[model samples]
Target: MSNDKIKEDLPAILERYRDRIEATIKPYLSLNLTPDENLTWWQSKFAGREKSPGGFPYLPKGFDYPQTSDGEYLLLLAQINFAEVPYLEGFPTRGILQFYIADNDSYGFSNYYCELNYPQSNWRVIYFPEPDLNAENLITDFDFLPEKYWFETTELEITKCSAIRWTKKYAPICLEDDSAYKLLLPQIGEAVPFELEDLYEEFTDAYLKILDNDGWFCPLQMGGYSCYFSDDPRVGFSEEEDPFDTLLLKISLIESGSLFFYIQSSALAKCDFSKVLYAMA
Candidate 1:
């Protein structure tokens, strides 16, 4: 199909979800953002954001973050005891986002990753990674741009216009309704799983490469406490044939980072998560 044809078709899927999402998914969907629900407020309890004095949507001095994304709660996350994979409450997997949201602050749209906790009354925001917007970065800002299209943006007007266009076209998928919403995941990459030792090795490599310049290249992050199948290393399952039979290594992550771990593949499969997440009771 033509690029224009592809773009045109994408919106219809988005439209269907918006029309019926609120009505069908009564429990998870929210039209308004609340302190109890939105991460901008909840995240304040943990590590605070670094804020500037006056800027787009300005806030007071010493203020860690901008005002709440009150009207912009994008998704509510929760996981079954054993939702899709057996690597419960580990890296890459948080919970399930009821949908998506493109909410951001002056820097850019901040996508919040939340998990449903006990009492089930509120969501625990694991972390939120803000956009790192530098002129150099925008050159590859494909998230906002439509596929099959690209152009240089040395001019400010051309740049602003592109961001506006990308947001409009790309951010609508999160508001999708039930049936059509099922298709959104497959469009993402496949989930690829890895072992803890392997992950640590990769992390060490990245940490060293960027240590001088202060960088971490490893993209995988783990949550929850680590577990082992047995005391013996030989009996443990790191790359077992069965996805469920493997022992889990829980690693704490820098909550501020945007790293993401995946299942066997980062690609989204039908009715399954790409990130193998494990949660505890």
Candidate 2:
């Protein structure tokens, strides 16, 4: 409300991703979505309807096209409208963005885009992609979302420091002091290093040992780095930029480590996590 559009960088960032988003959508609208061995899958779904003359079949009617405007993408990915979908009773949609996200680049996407449900510190993806054909949602949604599932806290980094939550305008950054929201590194299911299904037992111990050496004494919250957001109305808002060069969010229009109020999630399930994950990945 003070000067030039605080979110000015958003447009440039979206343009950077525009081509990739467009490229990703090509297959979803055609037979390419079905494997050669399952031609029947495509035939059955489309039935007798022919693809559009442009060679691109749009998503089924009633489905929401992705929000492609510059800043719109930011709001779609980072902000949420709580009035839309009810939170799963135990997993509150609001929480700090912890950093324990699984970094598996072999797949070109994080294992999870996690947020710790406030007060409880339980982790989960609010908008699990509701895949039902028709692209479900936009490639941008898939491009922006973190992995889905809940990671309960095993410890907490209870620090006396004031609660911290930094929001970015068009970037995937926000910090939830590892002290409060909790972050659990991949030891088992959610994110197995090298996709090694057998490392959980040995890795979790080694991981914890490292934390202990770092002065970690939490009895419950645990995990690697994560992003956080504040639900506190008293929390002030700014328009700095996002910290960390997240592969997917690296094109952020926001500066690095700048905290603002715009990144808060209202806990809306308006996205299709499963589809986006599959496509974006």
**For each predicted model, how many residue pairs clash, with residues at least 3 apart or on different chains?**
28, 31
Q: Model 2 over residues 178-218: C-alpha lDDT tens digits? A: 21211222123334557654444443343333222211111
Superposition TM-score, candidate 1 onto the true structure: 0.18
What tens digits encode model 1's per-residue C-alpha lDDT throughout 1-281?
Answer: 12112223323333443333223211111111111212221121111121111101111233232122453322212111112222322323332222121223211123223221222212122222232223333222123222212122111111111100000010121111122223433322233245344543443343233221101111111221122222212222245443331212121223332312222322222223323323211
TM-scores of all predicted structures: 0.18, 0.18
Compared with the true structure, all predictions reach lDDT values of 0.23, 0.22
